[model samples]
Target: MKNGKSPGSDNIPVEIVKVGRHRVIELLRIAFNKCLEEQTIPEIWNCAIVILLHKKEGTGEKAGSDHVRKTNEWLRHQSKVTDVIKRVARLKWEWVGHMARKTDTWSKRLLEWRPWGEKRPRGRPQMRWDDDIRQIAGTRWLQVAQSRDEWRSLKEAYTQVVETG
Candidate 1:
């Protein structure tokens, strides 16, 4: 539910959902539960809007005799799409660093704090938000994040590690 993303087929913006807040969350939860019980999602969920940009010159006019051929050619000529997973990982890593450096924000506190008396009901420990940060920057990642230059240097390696593993 990140902001500024394009609306889906429903054309409902994220801002509208944010305005609804808890009421929206509760409604969504109920709807999702009902969908799970019925084993069917809304038909609107299957719809998508795919807009093909006219990347080359002398294109984008109304369809004509050569439209299909030109569209196929343009599609074939396009390079591979950028890796979304790597981009998201890099962004998350950067955000973690930013939150880590903030002195007294609740975000920073929650990022570092573990519950005092929480009991685990699992064999293996669950993965955490900062697990990748710890993997790249070691146990002192928070301290390292305090230095912007040092944190920035780790971004490439972090993305690579995330991409591969």
Candidate 2:
């Protein structure tokens, strides 16, 4: 319903509906009734506008396709694909933490393993999977993820972060 938002497959912007909700509802009712009688959804519903984005690094700007922006502009404003990616990432981290807590020899070894005495190259150290996990889930994530309900709630928190930030 925000201004300057692009229309979906329906080609109807939320602003139009916002200004004339009753009339829009009536028109939608007719269209939906016809669709129901024909037992077919509109092909427009499947349409998505693809936009290409150029790569721009070190500018602190998001450089990618417009899918994320378009998804955030929907009528219902559902979560974008990035949110799913974040949720999956958090779940994988939780799974790893859960496995690390296991009493098995392999799990214990993995939890305690470290690289030999080798000097790292200059500049920023190479990013590790554990670093990304800690960045998203915090240092106490392992303890929080131990409980099923707590992990689920943590995932929800991550979901909100993904959606808003």
Candidate 3:
């Protein structure tokens, strides 16, 4: 085949027509390795890492969230990096500390920010953290917060729970 897809399709995502698969896998392997090597779990995973590789972007790749979910699920069962997983978990604690620092700064800024506004928005801004999210804010997490204070509080409370448990 001249390309991975049949020649008949008129519209093709450019990434599919251009980049090679082995290269893409190699990059993920690199990220995985770097994450392990640094003893850090990246705060961000580049959208381009997998988003650009979507079949919608490339004919050869899968586009649905299920595809990504299945991939991660497979990775979970694989025994290739059990030790690395533990190290990553330990790194998560450090990330919690970083999050606390960021949130404390945010809380301070928001306190100052209030002076700039005549009145805060009524009802809710949709970013407020409640009790349950705070409960899992640490070692075992469920959801994430957009603002730093909510994240810090959640992590702190969650950390207590993990320590007690």
Q: Which candidate has the top score in TM-score? A: 1
User: What range of 10 consecutive residues in model 1 has the weakest lDDT sum?
Assistant: 73-82
lDDT of each: 0.77, 0.62, 0.48
Question: Between prediction 1 and prediction 2, which has the larger lDDT?
Answer: 1
Better of 1 and 3 by TM-score: 1
Which residue pairs show backbone clashes in model 2?
A: none
TM-score of each: 0.53, 0.42, 0.26
Model 3 residue runs over 4 Å out of place are 1-31, 35-71, 79-118, 128-133, 136-165
TM-score, candidate number 3:
0.26
For 124-146, candidate 2 gives per-residue lDDT tens digits of 88877666556666876566556
lDDT per residue (tens digit) for residues 20-64 in model 3: 655655666677777778757765543223324343333434563
- List all candidate RMSDs to the true structure: 14.9, 12.5, 12.4
Global Cα lDDT for candidate 2 = 0.62
> Model 1 — TM-score against the truth?
0.53
Model 2, residue 5: distance off in Å is: 27
Provide the global lDDT of candidate 3 against the true structure.
0.48
Q: What shift in Å separates residue 110 of candidate 2 from its native position after superposition?
A: 1.8
